[model samples]
Target: MSHQRRRGQAAIVYPTKVYTDSRGSRVETADMDNPIPVTAVFVPQRSSRAEVAGQQDIDVTRMIVSADVQGIDSWSRVFWNGSMWDVVVPPAYHHGTRHTRHYTMDIRRRPS
Candidate 1:
């Protein structure tokens, strides 16, 4: 399966806490206790797709994976190449089988 050939390991982040600080402020943080190891290919968004998006300021990168990766949603974040990519939309799942499931993610690069 393509998942077996995955070379990059991605960290999946989820919110785990929200608390008030001593100075009467609220702080929200994410939890990164585990990483989802999957093979992924990163590619530049095609002009056709970009034009359809109709947003010129932000850049989009498409990530492809073949595995039944769990615990990810639009609210989740993916860490790769020393940068974080926000899940542009909910992950699209396809090609279901007894042991493998394919996932496609369209992620937007976050400002550094």
Candidate 2:
């Protein structure tokens, strides 16, 4: 269901798509008129043991603060046990968007 089209020396790329019928029994194919270019950048990390240790330290601090604020008195260093994160909320009520921060740090930092 994908093709490259050319007419009179003009080249065009289309993303052919598949569709399902209302009954969800029959499948149909349609040609796309325009092809969109999607671009993304990914950076690979090459870290030293020191950097890893620093990151782990920061993570530990953050988790401690998170547990303290959420009244997560009972926890396990290892997950999968019920008592681990139950200090914050009852095991049954664990749902919805809980308090968490989407944070980032710059790899380039001034030496302290």
- Give all candidate RMSDs, comma-separated: 5.9, 22.5
lDDT, residue 43, candidate 2: 25
Cα RMSD, model 2 = 22.5
lDDT of 2 by residue, 13-71 (tens): 12234567788875533233433221111122333334553543111111111111221
Clash counts for the predictions, in order:
1, 2
**99 Cα displacement, candidate 1 (Å):** 7.2
Cα displacement (angstroms), candidate 2, residue 35, comes to 3.1
Which lDDT tens digits does candidate 1 get at residues 27-55? 65434665665557677784322355454
Model 2 per-residue lDDT at 51: 58
Which one is best on TM-score? 1
Q: Which candidate is the best by lDDT?
A: 1
